[model samples]
Target: MASPTLTLHQYQTAASETDRTRTTKPTRFLLLGLFGEAGTLLDEVKKKQRDSGSYVGYEANVVEELGDVLWYLAVIASRMKLALSAIARPPEQSISSYATADNEIRFSDLQQQAHLPFAAPTSNFEITLLRLVAAIGALANAQQQSLPEGDEWGPYLREIFHILIQTANEAGVTLENAANENLTKIFDRWPEERHFPPLFDEASDIAEEKLPRHLEVEIYERTVARGPGIEKLYVLQRCSGILIGDRVTDNIMEPDDYRFHDVFHYSYAAVLGWSPVLRALFRLKRKSTPKIDEGEDGARAILIEEGVSTFIFAYAKQLNFFEGQHEGDLSFTLLKRVREFVSGYEPKHCPLWLWEKAILDGYAAFRFLQRHRKGRLILDLNNRSLSIKAI
Candidate 1:
């Protein structure tokens, strides 16, 4: 595979190209307008229902009004140049370099054959947050891409249903599973009420225990040249921002200003199986990330530094259930070192709901174009209808 030749300088140039990227403001304003109206309308409807006390008449209206709010979210995402694909993440090489030396980038970090699945579509504010986080976290975990899996916030929901189904199957949870089964519930709350139940648990034991794919992350070390506290979060945040890129216009954190609060928090919870991970992770003192005072220089500097890996790296990978399928993606040296781990367990049937789980959590269909020779997995929604693609 031909490796993509991306440099920190390339990212700098992209961000500094004030003339190249279009301002998303006009569409953003339009989304805000829609959001305002949809919110007011929903509030009025909700109020009426509350007053009536036995409100069951306009259920369809409630759904339609909620749909309107999601439409605005789509518009805002479009304005921001964000991919409406539910799960979003940074690139692979970036994640590979950061992770412990035992990982590879895979589709949203799943071991896969990019048969995009559907997750139980969710529109609730919290579920939306979960869907987005799952995408980004999977990316952070492996720095890979997948098929569009869904749409610009409309039918895009179908993809989540596909995912939810898969997640439930993997966790050995029933389709009627409640919030008690952490990973399974992520998929079960579909086909009926799409609203995500409150989180079952802070950590996903199923993911860590059952889907423990080995990672062969390339370790790169750097001496802290600036404030460690600020630099740590800044680098993490910058990784997410530029990785997320022009997609997601509503976020004002400008990539660099964003933090890995959610990513680190979630991972630590899952990995350590403890709450202390969150407290310990953020114990680093905070400092203000400096603004590039020299015209566009600062922004350029951050973009270059932060975006450098996304363009050049590969994160996600697909796993095969049996031996003899390493396909040379594994380096002989690393494989030799970890063959003990590989030999430790026989590959088992991964449940369908667990990505292995067979449930409708999100769209299972996607166009994950893997150019292994190039170390880049280009993603496309195949919006052949919309001609929309995310590279």
Candidate 2:
């Protein structure tokens, strides 16, 4: 079965639905976003040029950036109260006639077009990209100059869209692919439907292999001797009166109380319902399925979770451990990096807001532990929460 064709108007309509800035400075916010995305696109291209031979994932990067660019263009058109197909009219065609023409930018069409040779050389493609950027800049210039909106505006935007289409063609990218990928990325960040995603081990036949819905982990500090006249504080955790993972210290010359960072793993399990490290610690590896046991519940997955916890701790250290930030306050760049860290893992299915909640809630519990040095970390996957109880 074929995926339904995505026409320009359909894309613009869908993209507009996800536009959070529709009410708040819609034009200005979108214009600024357009420029920022354009700069990002240019930067990706710059990296490809600079690292020509060694640059891996160049096409993927281009597709992502191009998707972003297309999204901004679609929403910007929506803001101007014009259909995307209206702005996509060819240079020689009259806008009125093209407006009603078939606006389909289908995957099959892209596949057919992708085989055709580029009309220009690689250098020309680069120049065309510059022209596209300049065209975007011209939109800002017109807005700043208080240019009147009228008949010429349609043709003006068409030219920019023309350049954009040309650039995508020369880069061997399809606008349909760009649009679809952009929708995926955006919806992954700000999903239209909000609900609890299914737990990673929800279907496990082994009851003990499932993450505990509610866990009360007692974490305390113990003093250990490193050398004569030297003592270091190590953190240890226990659940159901049985000692779990090894004792940990700050692992740095300066004591930042990172020994308490296990709270982050618990946060992942509680909020995202996926934590390989915690699963390993609690003997919850889904061994019933050999592939699941090795691939999803194995050492590499545990390392990825641990790496995410430590990486986020470092990021939070710079922000005072997200002291005053709200649930949605984590920067998109940080979330994007975290997503990249666990790109192939099960947790990658979780959305941005959930990641934010896990981080903030984990730090909330961590901050409490850092101050008190010991506490009961209460994780309720049923409630999707992490709470601290003074010990």
Candidate 2, 1-391: lDDT as tens digits: 0124667767777788888768766475777887887777677778777887787777877778877878887777766666667677546656663234355644334344634332322787778888888888888888788755544455556767778777788877777777878787777667777688888887767788999999899999999898999997789998889988998978888988888988999999999998888888888888888998899889999889889888988888998999999865688889989998999889888888789888989999888987888999899998888999998
Candidate 1 TM-score, true structure as reference: 0.19
lDDT of 1 by residue, 58-96 (tens): 433333333333334334444334433322232222221
Give candidate 2's TM-score: 0.86
**TM values, all candidates:** 0.19, 0.86
Cα misplacement distance, residue 26 of candidate 2 (Å): 5.8
Q: Which regions of candidate 1 are displaced past 4 Å?
A: 1-25, 41-45, 53-56, 86-391
- Which segments of candidate 2 are over 4 A away from where they belong? 1-4, 95-121, 148-153, 221-231, 241-243
Best by TM-score: 2
Clashes of each: 89, 0
